[model samples]
Target: VRAEAIITRESGGGRAFHALVSSDGRRIEADLLVLSCGVRPRTRLASDAGLRTSRGILVDDRLRSWSDPRIRAIGDVAHVADPRRYAHEREVPGGPAGLVGAGWRQAEWLAGALIAGEDPSPFAEDSPGIVLLKSRHVDLVQGGEIVPDPFAPGSGEVASWADPRHGTYVAMSTTNGVLDGFVAVGMPRAAAELSLLFQRRGELPSDRSLLLRLDAAEQPVRATGRDETVCICNAVTAGGIEDAVSDGCDTVDAVGCATRAGTGCGGCRARIAEMIDEWQGQHV
Candidate 1:
């Protein structure tokens, strides 16, 4: 069979010696050192529970299952539906719900729907996912739809800057003047602000080249206003953090405990820390 490899022999008992051979001439002997790889949704329980499944447990915009309205779905094992026709979102792969931020968003929305009777809204499927690589000497953050080369005169525009010595690479994409996406490698400050911009769906600065400069994001980002989100997962904001600090939440942990600004995907944690330090500097 194509793309199929079989394990011929396995023995991991008694004195604990096991040998496994793959078709690619790879052999391993172990009593289970570690087998790590990408993961998938856990849908057995949902399937046994007799809910609809399309690669995951399916649910409507309110997160209620079609077969059972009382049972709402969420997280990696759920397939959520956005009811609005314009949303252009549906059961994406690796979900009933997926991504920590989106999961938390669903949770908050669900909490409101259940507690305050708030109606659920459509999810923006094309919304960016902030990805920060957690590794030594490697800093990377990516968000939004960056393909199709936004700068090619049809979609929008693209601008980038590279610093090979400190190992920094930054590229920003804009579609019809609004920021579409960005990728920042070894440029933590740009990564942080770009993530915020992507989340807020803010327009690009008239001077697009400003995106590649380290100093440009600060003042413009400050003008994004307090209402624009700083943490979508927890609904935290620039103003919210300011108010929290004024109320004596001085540290990042304290602010997180108080307003949950830096507790989700942790992409916003750096920004939150900066906000705290900046606030303390002004007071001191």
Candidate 2:
């Protein structure tokens, strides 16, 4: 691995990239170049306004700025320093979650507290927020504290399976038979089931390897439950989509307009479409 090598320019041998010229005069040959420049939270406004800033505007569990309780922050800018269940006596930690769903949840809760005059409890995130890569060529889903050493003193039970030939991999960590963290690649069915189980904090079956069977060719795809969240970004459920379909929503867009299912992230659009077809078939 070239540590901290900065690419200055690209050289092409044919139609595509052939090599990268670095500042230190290193020519790194490559067939494909993927640029993955990450984002930084813009906290200048908060910092200039005198609110503490680190990675983002540091806020309490209530999302109120430590320096100014009247001033609140949310979305990509707010850094939650004091999370729920964390004692004040303990060191403050946490930062911007960088997830749209988390931001949506924060906004919804904050609106209720500010405008609706609701007694809002401490804002709690869906711990270890789910990440989905919405793409046709690749199916990847990850969530929770996945980096723990499985063999560590208290790392919990870890199970993994790989089929490199099929480009499928599954690895999960659980505590006391409960799913804690997982990463699934190239296995859509397993990813969906794992996501649901992670969200619900459900227990894994005794034979955890059963999850592998979800992607088998002979195994029929399981139907989602009515209560299962179809669009996590909007908290839209399968039943919600069914209701929309029953109300004459024929297309995915119509269902989205009716229930706001596929509007966020677009990862659940395929699922919404599937639900629409299933429900429409039932009606027919």
Candidate 3:
């Protein structure tokens, strides 16, 4: 499996793929092959057409190609090059976001611009994008600068814990007690709390160990903050959901349609439902 080079893949009759032949003449047979390599923008056609490209098709604030006004790029193939767009200190290098939420935002904006026939506000970057991986066997959530070296100059407190046997790990770094970087694996509750703190720029508990308790033995856990985000994909907060409910969005689907909260990934639907129930209980 660690062969230096995968020379060829052979397909047998009646099978989608039969075997992989390595440079060392080893033939590995498998029922499925999963390639986990990351993605790159497919700009070959644009490049052949003599369009400007750097990391992706170079675009301005309006998502129009710098080289060709007629050709616009969005989604993972756009590198928005507007220097004034990103004012944050931790801005990512200029390139395509390669994220579904970002793509949706771009599509919506572009559609509106085309329909109204007027220039809209420049598309903005969503810094510190949340990453979530949910599976039957593993759960992971990460955001921000997850690995600031504790020994580095100007770095803040860094705390970490790992339980490999239980497939659990948590690490966080704070800037003046504010959660700036974090990562969690296999600890869903802790991960959720960390995510909220990260979104709110909330201070971590003075005793970092308190977070471990949330995931330790899987005790009852809830992160209590309505101003913090719940639907990261749409940047919707618990407070936003409450407002929607107060505005007569009585059902989960109604809330989704009103705020576009649970429309993406659907990871926050249960929380949206819970918020609705809590609101109704209080009002009654």
Best-matching candidate per lDDT = 2
* Runs off by more than 4 Å, candidate 1: 1-39, 82-97, 116-128, 134-138, 148-156, 215-235, 265-270
lDDT of model number 2: 0.77
Sort the predicted structures by TM-score, highest score first.
2, 1, 3
Question: What does candidate 3's lDDT look like per residue over 1-284, in tens digits?
Answer: 46443333445644365566776778787765655454599999999999877788888888988778787789889888863453332443678877667787788889998899976888776446777653335567888875556787766788999888888899898888999989888876687789888867889999998988877664633335666577767777777887899999999999999988888777777768777887888789
TM-scores for all candidates: the values are 0.68, 0.80, 0.66
lDDT of each: 0.66, 0.77, 0.76
lDDT of 1 by residue, 1-284 (tens): 12223333434543433555555667665444324233478878877888767766777667777668789877666676543431244544435434566677777667777786656564334355665554445667777656546446554577777777877788888777677778888765566567777877888788765656654434533414566466655657789988998899988889999987878766666667777787778899
Superposition TM-score, candidate 2 onto the true structure: 0.80
Q: What shift in Å separates residue 150 of candidate 1 from its native position after superposition?
A: 7.6
* Candidate 2 residue-wise lDDT, 1-284, digit = tens: 35334344434543555577676777787656766444589988887888777778878888888888888899888888763444333454666877777888899889989896654778887545787766567778887877546687877899888888988988999889899899999987788778889988989999988888878888643344677666766777777888788889999999989888888778778777777776767678
Model 1 lDDT vs. the true structure?
A: 0.66
**Model 1, residue 26: C-alpha shift (Å):** 19
Q: Judge candidate 3 at residue 277 and give its lDDT.
A: 81
Q: What's the lDDT for residue 149 in model 2?
A: 64
> Which window of 10 residues has the lowest lDDT sum in candidate 2?
1-10
